[model samples]
Target: MTKESLKELILTLEKIQLVLIQEGEQEWVYGISSIKRRLTDINIDSPDFKKEFKSVQLSYLNMTNGAGSFSDVMIWRSNVEDRIKVNKDFNALTKKTWELFEL
Candidate 1:
């Protein structure tokens, strides 16, 4: 991706991060899809960083287990710790992705 696109990508992630933080699991579906689509649109010069982002999206995909239906919310809410962990993982990767520019 161009440096401008990469900057936009990270900013998008940061925005999604806020959505995840402020809303319920159901609210995350839109942001998740947006971020994943954003990733696909990126064309990075470094293959390894590209691969890393692809791997990162895998973690995000895991969070979509039931797509936040009422039943899923019932189950997911019971395991608040996992939800928190999921948020933290995404946040960590989002932060880590900025290091790609150091190259």
Candidate 2:
């Protein structure tokens, strides 16, 4: 990905983080949807980064579908853990992706 695209992705991830913190689990579907859409727009060439991104996406997808209510999707402990892991993984991947930018 180009530096500009990487920067955009970082911004998107930051937005996701904010949404997760302020809105909590119920609103995460929106953030995840935004992240997925943003991911599709970037050209990711690294296999490792692609894998990491996919991991985060899949985790969110599973959590989003685990419960009937999008607002209370994390009613279970496992679901809550999955969301935490997804956030952590996305944050790490975002940092790694940022390091690849030239300037």
Candidate 3:
């Protein structure tokens, strides 16, 4: 993928992280599957990154379908209240998730 799109995906992940922390509902962040789908293509040589990302993927799988319910987060996404701040900026999101992924 292009660098810009990758950044955008990472930023999306960051926003999801922000909402999960701020809103306390991890299942509401629907963009995770998008990021998970791209994991095989990231091409990062860091084993730690790979291991951590794989953990995320497995967690996502368990949360939605693997062992968890099929409750889709998109249904909740359409119901987000305006007062909740899920639309945080990319730089902050980037920085936050950077620390999270330990990249």
- The candidate maximizing lDDT is 1
Query: What ranges in model 1 sit over 4 Å off?
Result: 22-47, 69-103
lDDT for every model? 0.55, 0.53, 0.50
In what order do the candidates fall by lDDT, top score first?
Answer: 1, 2, 3
Please write out the lDDT profile of model 2 over residues 1-103, one tens digit for every residue.
5556656656665655555556455456465566656565655666567665665555545544545633243322358777787657556644543343221
- The TM-scores of all predictions, comma-separated, are 0.35, 0.33, 0.36
Residue pairs with clashing backbones, model 1: 1-43, 1-44
Candidate 2 least-lDDT 10 residues = 69-78
Regarding TM-score, does 1 or 2 come out ahead?
A: 1
**What digit string (tens of lDDT, one per residue) describes model 3 on residues 59-92?**
5455545334533222223545632333333235
Q: What is the Cα-based TM-score of model 1?
A: 0.35
Q: Which candidate would rank higher by lDDT, 1 or 2?
A: 1
